[model samples]
Target: MKLACIENIRRQKQHVERYKRQLARHRSGEDISLKSQKTFRKPKQEKHLKSFQVYKDVLFDEFLDKSKKLQKLTNQILKVLSQVWESPK
Candidate 1:
């Protein structure tokens, strides 16, 4: 009976130590994974930001072109109106 009790205690100790080591390994592995994730995301974030700026530039150029076209059309209409008004009998 005493030997059985002693063996049970030993088994419990071994189990606790094994669990502790496994927990530590899991924590360290998580830290390594997070560090690598940050390293990987940094460059992707910069590239996304860079592309956003390029997209903004292209959108601005399109808006500017359309604005100039509208301005030109307005000027042509005003010139035609002026010519019609000046042709008095």
Candidate 2:
């Protein structure tokens, strides 16, 4: 429970920081950072090709398997977050 809260807080901080950086870039009329000009890329059409891409880190692990016990715990977190779209305390 406590570890989940910490992870939520960390994600929230990252969200806020990205928003701040975007706002700063808008005000200055410039791209937010180096490499920011890259156009959006679609998800890989081939699973094997994605391994060479950035979201290689986001590949689903056993810990997030939909059939696992953590599945229900994950639902509860989604329920809480949906109520306000904010990370739980």
lDDT of each: 0.82, 0.76
Error of 1 at 38 (Å): 34
22 Cα displacement, candidate 2 (Å): 0.9
Query: Which candidate has the highest lDDT of all?
Result: 1
Give the poorly placed runs of model 1, Cα more than 4 Å off.
1-58
Q: Give the TM-score of candidate 1.
A: 0.34
The sequence of per-residue lDDT tens digits that candidate 1 reaches over residues 37-68 is 46544667888999998887777778999999
- TM-score per candidate, chains pooled: 0.34, 0.36
Worst 10 residues of 1 by lDDT: 30-39
Candidate 2 has an lDDT of 0.76
List, residue by residue over 1-89, the lDDT tens digit for candidate 2. Answer: 99999999999999999889888987998855655546556556765576657566665775477557677888988898798766566
Which residue pairs clash in candidate 1? none
Error of 1 at 13 (Å): 60
